[model samples]
Target: MTTTASVQVYTTNYCPYCTRAKQLLTKRGIAFEEIDVSNDDEKRAWLVKTTGQRTVPQIFIQGSPIGGSDELHQLDRSGELAKRLAAA
Candidate 1:
């Protein structure tokens, strides 16, 4: 149950939530792929279409959407994030 799920985060450069999310993931020793959509209209549009969310800090864990910073923090606090991260 230690499968390293690939984490992908869509964020902007100046988003505080994005910063916090990255920090939390780093603290947990998780490596993630960060896509900065600050000026990329196409990617942002794709995110909106794909997630129905037009905000920075959109995250996907092992191809599963895990939402933004608040949700991620909540999951971490509830120990769900750890469980998800450890899932095979």
Candidate 2:
């Protein structure tokens, strides 16, 4: 059986890390939902509520928060990202 993973990225305009994060996902052929918190107050609040941090590019796969870009890169390096993507 094959399952499609749902990835969500909470981001803002001009965040270089956000761009890099998206590039990484795109390079992996992963589709994702991008939320722009650049000017949306409600979105910002929601991001903070869900992640407990005001960081751009808060990623979630299968409804699990995977943290910011740095954390994501770490996961990729440690080989856990593949596992998560597979699970998704």
TM-score of 1: 0.92
Which 10-residue span in candidate 2 carries the lowest summed lDDT? Answer: 1-10
For model 2, residues 1-88, the per-residue Cα lDDT tens digits are: 2236888998999899999999888777778889888999998898889889988989999888999899989998998988888876
Question: What lDDT score belongs to each candidate, Candidate 1 first?
Answer: 0.90, 0.87
Task: Give stretches of model 2 more than 4 Å off.
Answer: 1-3
Give a tens-digit lDDT track for model 1, residues 2-75: 33689999999999999999999988888889999999999999998988999989999998888999999999
Where does the lowest 10-residue lDDT sum fall in candidate 1? 1-10
Positional deviation of residue 61's Cα in model 1 after best superposition, in angstroms: 0.3
